[model samples]
Target: MATSPTPALPLPADRPLLGIAFMLAAGLLFTLLDTGVKWLTQSYSPVQIVWARYTGHMLVLGAYLLMLGWPRCRAIMTSVESLPGQFLRGLLLLGASTFAFLAFRELPLLQVYVINFSTPLLVTLLAIPLLKERVTLARGLAVATGFVGVIIAIGPVDWRAQPAALLPFGMAFCFSLYQLATRRFGRNDHPLASLFYAGLAGALASSIIVPFFWSPIAMGDIPLFLVVGTLGAASQLGLIMAMRCAPASLVSPFLYLQIVWATISGYLVFGDVPLIETYLGAVLIVGAGIYLATRRG
Candidate 1:
């Protein structure tokens, strides 16, 4: 049986709850992929892991498109001439992934994830200047609350603060830019086609880095690397389907699930249990995100 063709998306109203659930699921998969990348660092270089992820993501996505008669992939290549912002978004996304992969090597998985969740806060802050988006009082307060949670997640910044922890923060900031650019440029390009190119961009960028920073891949690490790629594709496709079903505001909050997913994965895989402050911070960030999402104007 053929899957029902997705109904055209209307603005901010249709099936909001369902879309949010889909986004939540996507976030869960994404963080699982993140955890796998984190684990691989014990035996593989971050660049190698990143390359593997791209390799897997491309193969999976390519296979999907091939199944669909190579719809979006063809369009992405033919239409690249007209899509500068998507290219820029891809470049920033690649940078963000690089930073994130490096951070995974340096920091605990839970800390890295919670810190990246601070992207929404950075998005709020950047909108005033980059997108000229008007800021509301609720969102301002929420951004503040979110940052407080981030600091809590980071623990006290001491002399022993790992220099590598900054990479995730940088990833958050750059990924926030990628989000903004997605909105700015997605007007002309289909989202999936744009994403295909973005994945290609990531793969190409890693080609250079994987040389100097490359390590020999162990057979043990291949499965996790495959998971990272396959799950990343699934998560992106899920997210795209979700946006078509419901408004972004409804689904956006679920991105925070990365923190939850990371927390659970860390506990099970690495014996890293959450501290009291971590839970407290999660509550504050979630509450603030809820407020910000629900606020009107």
Candidate 2:
């Protein structure tokens, strides 16, 4: 009998550089989205703004699916391997978005971004239990360091006076959980399908409440709403693509770039200046995050 040809080994899945690029682009887009949300918070409730974000996400996703034709669209729609997981991911993200929008209404853009940087630390800790991953001593130290950074960034806030100061931490926690869910459930799903369902829960939840919060949107503000939605959808897709291309650890550090963008945007658009503590705390947080990302067990 003829010997069978040796089977080819599968190629490694990661493309770290490409993932970093995607992450960087996503960070920029997210900054723009946050800026738009902040601006809109002046005229719209967080619920209404979130509704626009997810509704636009669905619209953009629908248009793309339609462009791929009926068969492909149907396949993507039907490709749910973990419907519950997808829904949970959507809810977690919705919670994150709600917290973030609320924080934006009360806080400076840079401060909000800095506090949310604690997400990487939260993800690292949560992964041990949720993802069943091992954590080394170095990673543990890194997490501690990042936590210190968060405290420094939050420097001397009077809780009763600045109650909204706590919102970013809530956003970070929800977002960390969302990231874990995405890592667990996203691996086997089609990218388009994952993107669709990621926004679906938020869209439905917000739609139910948005009518109550509705402010008649101005014609000029229509474009701003559209931009918020489009940017949210596009940035989310970019994050999915980044995770697909590389491990989350590698891509996670690039998210710190958003702080830079947020600082610049905060200054230019709102004439806001970041405090010295914000800069110092951001440094520690970003450094710890980078360490946690690169020093794998």
Q: Provide backbone clash counts, one per model.
A: 0, 0
Candidate 1 lands at a TM-score of: 0.88
For 26-125, candidate 2 gives per-residue lDDT tens digits of 8888899999999999888988999999999999988888899999889887887899888887898899999999999889999998878778789889
Error at 199, model 2, angstroms: 1.0
Lowest lDDT 10-residue stretch of candidate 1: 1-10
Question: RMSD, each candidate, Å?
Answer: 4.6, 7.3
- Give all TM-scores, in the order shown: 0.88, 0.91
Worst 10 residues of 2 by lDDT: 1-10
CA lDDT, every model vs. true structure:
0.72, 0.83
